[model samples]
Target: MVWGRKKKRGGRKEPVFGGVAASLAELRLNPLDRITVADDKPASRAAPRKAAGPGGDGSRERKPSQNRKGRKGRARKRTRGRLSRLFYWGAVLALWGGIAIVGVVVYVGAHLPPIQSLEIPKRPPTIKIVGADGSVLATRGEMAGSNVSLKDLPPYLPKAFIAIEDRRFYSHYGVDPIGILRAAVTNVLHMGVSQGGSTLTQQLAKNLFLTQERTLERKLQEVELALWLERKHTKAQILELYLNRVYFGSGAYGVEAAAQKYFGKPAKDVTLAEAAMLAGLVKSPSRLAPNRNPEGAEARAKVVLAAMADAHFITEQQARAATTRPSYAVKPVGAGTINYVADWVGEVLDDLVGQVDQNIVVETTIDPKLQSVAEAALIDELAAKSVKFNVSQGALVAMTPDGAIRAMVGGRNYGDSQFNRAVMAKRQPGSAFKPFVYLTAIEAGLTPETIRQDAPLDIKGWRPENYGHEYFGAVTLTQALAMSLNTVAVRLGLEVGPVNVVRTAHRLGITSKLEPNASIALGTSEVSPLELVGAYAPFANGGYAANPHIVDRIRTVDGNKLLYARAQAAPGRVIDPRSVAMMNTMMEQTLISGTARKAGIPGWTAAGKTGTSQDFRDAWFVGYTAKLVTGVWLGNDDNSPTRKATGGGLPVEVWTRFMRTAHEGMQPEPIPGTQRGGPLPDIAQLGRQVIAPAPAAPASVGGPPQPVRANVRPEAASGLDGWLVDRLFGGR
Candidate 1:
């Protein structure tokens, strides 16, 4: 507070503040320092203070030792220019990057389907074809067993998928940057693309809503959809959707289907090994399918097991045990011939229930027992005789007398060829077609006792010959049919008019087109084995026409809704009762003493006709009991000639094998019109052959309508036919 200067004469004594300013100016210090102190002076510029200022007090305002000019020489004035450094630009760049990210998100979001309207597509319907026994024979449709709930599946099954496909499946926000980085680094380390970054949720998005395109647009959409899914659905729900929608190999579309297809079990019953195997299939379904490549599937399964162990989903021992003995896919029981049935059912599903828009069950009429027998019969017989007889293919169709199909084997090996020979192939029936001609003749007032000469004769340019070109001069009508005498058949066809024979065939069941010519009796018309077998059904049912039918009733899978059912309306009578009886008698002789003796059903009454096509191109024997009518054909796909293989030979043998087992445990029903115990009353009226002392002469019989008589026993009379077959044809 002490004054530094005396007052001037004209001015009041200097104010204290003014003196302080003057003192500062005199000291060459800043005038502003009077109120605001300046920065501390540099130690090098401070002058040493006089010792305690003569009073030993140390507190003193030190003076500058260096001049202000000297201080100015050591420092520079501030300059103005750009203020930004690297850190400043870094902050600005970060803001722009955030905007770019937002813009990209919006662009991807724009392409997404409306979240409000987004919905899972409807699962395609599966058609399950069931056998007559109501057992599942095969499944036909887009998915084998598509819809399976996660709760229904074994815990290990889904865990196996989670371990191998998405390790952080529970934690990620759909798009896993950590996973992406890890995959990138792994790929870089391997110097190739080795790891995949897609989560299970991403895969499900691709399958459900996107085409399998690798374009950036699709990928971005997939990412956006995955994120949306994560937000909208619980982790478990998303996982379940993925499991139910993901593809498996071999036309299987989901874990349920894959489980049934490969392991022959439901997803819920899947073992640890099976779960691992199925999970491995998600990576490359086609390549890792067990059926296609068991080794690759097993190796991939081991990888899945290891992953499961690493994820702590399964114990190390369990994983090790699964890898030790790798799981194998089961060969489905409903393979081979069963698949043929499945295909046949598939072809008829539309007609039965209209378009197959929903899951349905087709209850077929196939007898599983007979089906196995028929397949085995055809395959075993062909395996033994196909090369020798030059017959490369064979088919069999068996049905109840009411026309419910019992068994159908379309080919020797269904895997080799899918062409359904039983229902699709049309081949000449040869003498197997004589029933129509005989039936027509019987309808025209001729009896089974009517005599017809077996002597060969030419009709126009066609001269039908018997198997050995030999003739039995005076054989009865029954004898002619039993012997399969082509000349007699032709003579009868001309006598009744081939057009009439064709009409008779059509009335019975044959749907194939027939040419009305003399050779029609010789079976020049091409007919599928199905048509031939169906036409023979009238005789087995005693006069009713039962068109061959495989589908008995069709309905929805739940069995609550009925789609179709065969009508209870009566089957129309195809053949006259008297004529039917007459035809049965004549055909029965064919089994007893005809070319088809080898095809006779042991301990049961059965009748069928055997035919050998010209050049032995086709051999057929269509036989029937009161219970069943079966037709078998042996030939080549190219219609190549067989090596003298006649209907009386391999065809007869095959028929015998199948019928023997088919008729097991069945009662021996007498052939209709034949003696059950006592001779049929009015044997003449019933059309039973009136075997008397000798063959009746035309004068005694008054042409042909009057019943004729013969002395020969049926057993003795049948010997001639069997002898001729064995001698002329290579018959068993």
Candidate 2:
């Protein structure tokens, strides 16, 4: 319209700028520019007229508005179709997913026990053995400590676990959806399941009601049980239960037990760093146990502290302090083979406390200090000398003269083996059996002065020979016993009958079966170290038979009700006073100049016998003082012979080490019915004289005696002189 001035005559001519304004408005810079100029003709007609060529025809111009409407209609139809298809497939997939989830839940739930009937099972009974001085020796069975509450634990303790195990524990209902989602994303990124999303409640539910099987079914059941637990108990109670029921390593099954096992303290007393170390054990108890893997445990504890800081439960400074502060666990006082004493106590629990169905405490005769010494001495000896002697294992058993076992070491390493070589293994005692043989002969009217032919002897086709195969012709019985002469023992066994020797051993406390053959004199019969030590007690305890008891008292842990207390009474006399004296005299000589001379305990009068089985399969030193009876055995478990490991070697060394420690502060006592003095009696000189006729009453010292034999040598010493000399310096 501006190109040719609009027919302006009477109608005021449209301003030329009017068209410019319209054009400016129509030059749409954005969608909001919809201004138009007024005209008499229709706007469509005006547009055609403006775009028409000089011929005044508008056919050549294109109309974009109509075409835009049709194209938009087609696009609307396609979008609607796409939305319909997407909705249909989404609904189909959702249905299948729901069905699959329901099927899994049902299948897993069906395999579980009835929910109504489920209950937490009772833990195995724990036998707590205490030492004679009231210190804890060891624990047997499940080492379940006293129950601990999460509230009582240090605040940082529970927080540490929460941060590392389930950070959203308080906010989550039962199972954490956010945690599971995050774990899923992390696992996807790692291409494996490296993190666990189980909540504390979930772990508790599994430990209480389910087996630890890594199956989808078990996981589903765990979720269901977690929900049930949440409904049944508060979060505090659930956490307490979890802490009290979770297992740590080293036979410990509770937070308290783990605390004691690792830090040697109770959970309530655990330090912040200690608590972190214990809390880190949840992932892999055995692998991360502080006592077992301190480095791994420390590494894990640092992770926990870092997590705690991230959760705002601990400050960055606190985390740094904890990380730098090394965490160490003080090993329990008697943790190793000292457990052998605990094992023995558990075995006898049923007899000591009838129907041991609940937690009970057993007061054992073990002296914790002595037990430690014995274990150290035995373990150290074996480690140092066992290889050299071709010995693989050893055992030690020590007891009071009254049969109260003070210490017992069953093996070199309890973790390597728990076979209880001290109380269970039945190995030959070797020449240690000669004591009973001599005792029997003494009872059968023989004296230490009796002359025994040490030459070769054959009994029932068994030709017993001396250790060196060298026989000293006409040796006194004391010399024969001191030398551990196998031939002399065989002769005496044949003279007294093997049956009587067996009777003597049984009367003294040998419970194992004994063979009555002539070989029995050489300890062909197998017996445990416990029984052998016990049987030797009569010589040390003034002829009293030791029962070899361990448990002194038993009582309920909670109620303090007495289950059993050892009845105090005089020990039964197993032998005559004269026989005990004779046995002591003969055995004492062993410590002075015999095979067991290496086993002497300085400043104390001690007596014992050394035994080396045929082929060196077993080496033993059963020695004792007036205060203690100790037996040591060194050998191979498979009964393979050692490299000439005679009883005078490793076994004696171990016995000496242990006995020296055991009698550290004890007062010395002379051998019963004997005196320490100058020289030993010349028994060989007395052999030249015949015995005088015996008086019916006790013979007076320094008195002339009647002669029973016709040929009496004038040069021979009198019986009183011989007796005095023999008693004064017998051992030397």
Residue 706, model 2: lDDT of: 20
Local distance difference test scores for all models: 0.79, 0.80
Given candidate 1, what's the lDDT at residue 237? 91
Q: For model 2, how many clashes?
A: 5
Error of 2 at 85 (Å): 15
Task: Report the lDDT tens digits of candidate 2 across residue range 203-295.
Answer: 999989888889877888999999888888899988888888888887889889888788778899887788788789999997987776778
| Cα lDDT of model 1 by residue, 1-732, tens digit | 867887678875544655764565455533333454445576365544433222443234435554556566545321111234556788899999999989988888788878778887877788888888888887788665757777788889999999999999988989888999999999999999899899888998899899988988899899988988888899989999988888888778888888888887888888899999999999999888888788888899999999999999999999988888766766632337877788898898788778878888888998888999999898899999889989999999999888899999989887678999999999999988999999999989988878776554545545556665555555678777877777677778877887899999999888989999868988899999998999998898879988788898888877889999988789999887788778877778777666776667777777888888878899999888888888889999999899988888887888889988999998888655554333222212212222223332332111222232334233333233445346533421
Best by lDDT: 2
Global local distance difference test of model 1:
0.79
